[model samples]
Structure formats: structure tokens, C-alpha cells
Target: MNSQFNFRFSALLILLVATLVTACKKGDNVVPSPDLGAQVAGTYTYSELKTGGKTYPASDTNLKGTIKLTRQTATTVAIQLAIVHKATNETFADDAAEDVEVVESGIGNIELHYNGDTIAKIKGTKISIEGEDDAGTLFTLFATK
Candidate 1:
């Protein structure tokens, strides 16, 4: 009976520790994980672009790539989009690039950074690239695990 009680007590102690760790959390300003939402961690498949009705190809010309994101601070981050469309023309894919620079992520949105004329960032899910030939061209991306 004592052994069983001891096991139960030990389990209860572990549970209590976990509960404290979770409930008595530190302040968000203390050790913020802004990077958790800052950069794109893995490979993302582009199945849809939320901007225009333009469709992606089944095999090639489909927008698919890995964007390496790094949070510079709580209000800013840097992302680089790699060009990985095999059947896509050089002008299109070559026009796309993987360059690193800081942009606005202060509003906690999915930031889209790309280059058409010059590089710019659009924060939100709609994939909005401002001031371009293809304004509002949807960028379909997913975080690849």
C-alpha cells in the first residue's frame, strides 16, 4: 500500500510541477519567441495564390519553394525566398530570388517578401505585393514540416 501511495504521490508531484511551469509563465516581453512566428521554418507548397484568379501548373510553373525567415526583433524579420520552379521560365523564376532583408512584421501577420521590380514585403495571407505589374498576384505558400 505504501509503495502504491508513493507512486501516486510521485505522479502527483510531476503533475504539479508541470502545472506550475505552464501556469506561472514568464512575461512575453521577458523572453519573447517572436522568431516562432517570424520566419518560415520548412518547405512550403504553393497550391493557391489568394490574389488573382491566375492558376498554378499541375507539374511545373507551380510556385513552390523554401523561405528562410529570421526574426531580427519583435517588430521586424528577414526572409529569403528561394526559386525552385523547374519548368518555369528563367525570366519568371530568375526574376524571383532569395535575398535577405528586414521588413515589417510588427502586426503579427504572414509576411510575403519578393522581387519583381524591387523587393518588397506584404504582411497578411492575401499575398499582396504593392506597386507591381502583377499587383495582387497571390503567393501560395505553406510551411513544409
Candidate 2:
């Protein structure tokens, strides 16, 4: 009876080990999340073009800037933006950090709100981002790494 019990226990142990091994196999349905920090850390040259408004002269509608993206965490980034009007050479600057939502492997979105309205909308990957701010004035940023 003792020998029979030992054989049954050994067989059960082997079956358990086999089940665990199968559960940990590589081809299982589990998938690893992509690393977001490594994909969006860089300095990008940006241009802000304003149009369709009577706020400024046509010559002053174009501006240039530089945007820097620093990774704050796996799901957050720090944005530094500076823009200068081409005609008047006036400068506008803004700095903020936001927690971004990943849209896919290489895409993300960040929205900045002022008084419940989304003043700035940021969407991009590591290579570039399209930023738009709509607060009294309209400006769109085209950024490239």
C-alpha cells in the first residue's frame, strides 16, 4: 500500500509540473506591453502657423519654435515649447507635463485643458507630433524630430 501511494503521488507531481510548464510556454496568449519611454524622448523643430483669423496681420501668422520631449515615466512626458513670430519676432512659450495615453505601439495622445476647454491637443510618435492650441487664438504646431 505504501509503494502504491508513492507511485500515485509521483505521477500527480509530474502532471502538475507538466501543466505549469505548458502554462508558461512562449506561444501562449499573453503579450508584453511596448516600452513607451524609449520611443518619445527627443528634441524637435516646430513651426506654428496661424490662419483664418483677424487677430494678426498675414505676415505675422507664421512662427517657428523648438519642442523638447522628455520621458517622465512609462506613460508620461514633459513638453517644453517655445515659439517666435517671424514678422515681429515676438515670442510665446509654454511648458507642461502630461500623462499620455498610448493609442498603439508608436502613437500617443495628450490633451491640455484650460477652464474646461482643451486648449492644446498633442498626438504623435517618437518622430513627430501635431500640437494645436485654441485659446483666444488658434495655432497649430508641426513638429519633427
Candidate 3:
């Protein structure tokens, strides 16, 4: 009878311990959004296109090359631009480096600024830079990861 009673108490204790352990299990916790600078840091395929408030394929000589962007701070980045005219190999922005600011808040649109001017807008995996050259030739750069 004593052996039988001991077995019953031990079984109850085991069941209670199992219940307590299961009750202490953790639940899923949500993760926060990633930083804008961290997400945009990488290499990209840079395409130079004619600009009429939109992108259009132009000659390969319209400054065709890759653009490399490296994050320097939460609101600043170092840019390495290398572009060339395929016909004459006339390079534009060849190794031209600049530090630009990233505006991420207050308007809800992520934009890259150079000299307090909006140089590019970041959307998803794409970045578009629209401006004129030193000769006043309007062009747009579409870069994608």
C-alpha cells in the first residue's frame, strides 16, 4: 500500500512539473523595421537615360557605368560614381565621390540630397537621379540592386 501511494504521488508531481514548464513557454515577439541607410547599402546597376520627367533609353554614351554607394552615417552616405560615354569613352563622374544626406522622415519619402537639393528618390530596390550635366543636358540615372 505504501509503495502504491508513493507511485501515485510521484506521478502527480511529474504531471504538475510538466504543466508548469509548458505554461512558462515564450510567445512570438514582433521585430522592428530596419534602418533606411542599412537597407540601401549595396552595389547597383547604373543606367543613364534621357529625361523628360521620365526615363527613356538613350545612347550608350549618355554616361553609362555603375554607381557605388556606401553608408557613412544614419543621415549621410559616401557616393562613388563612374560613368562614361560608350562612343568616345568620355567619362563623367569617374570616381567622383561625394557625401550626401539622406532624408528619411518628416515627409514619408526617402530622398538623397546633395548640397541641400534632392538628387535622388529611393523606392524599393530602385533609385532615380534626375538632373542636368555640366553642359545643361538633362538626364536621368536609374540604378537598381
Error of 2 at 101 (Å): 6.8
What is the C-alpha local distance difference test score of each model?
0.45, 0.57, 0.70
Q: Model 2, which residues run further than 4 Å from truth?
A: 1-21, 26-30, 47-50, 53-61, 98-135
The CA-based lDDT of model 3 is what?
A: 0.70
lDDT accuracy of residue 5 in candidate 2: 100
TM-score of each: 0.36, 0.53, 0.61
Cα lDDT for residue 41, candidate 3: 71
lDDT of 2 by residue, 1-145 (tens): 9999999999999999999999889568777665555455677676434345433333355666777767766655566776666667777656555554323332366443333444444566323333445565544555566
- Between candidates 2 and 3, the lDDT winner: 3
Candidate 1: Cα lDDT at 17: 100
> How displaced is residue 140 in candidate 3, in Å?
1.6
Candidate 3 residue-wise lDDT at 114: 85
Error of 3 at 53 (Å): 5.6
Q: Better model by lDDT, 1 or 3?
A: 3
* Deviation from native of the Cα of residue 116 in model 1, angstroms: 16
Report how far off residue 104 is in candidate 3 (Å): 2.2
Give the candidate number with the greatest TM-score: 3
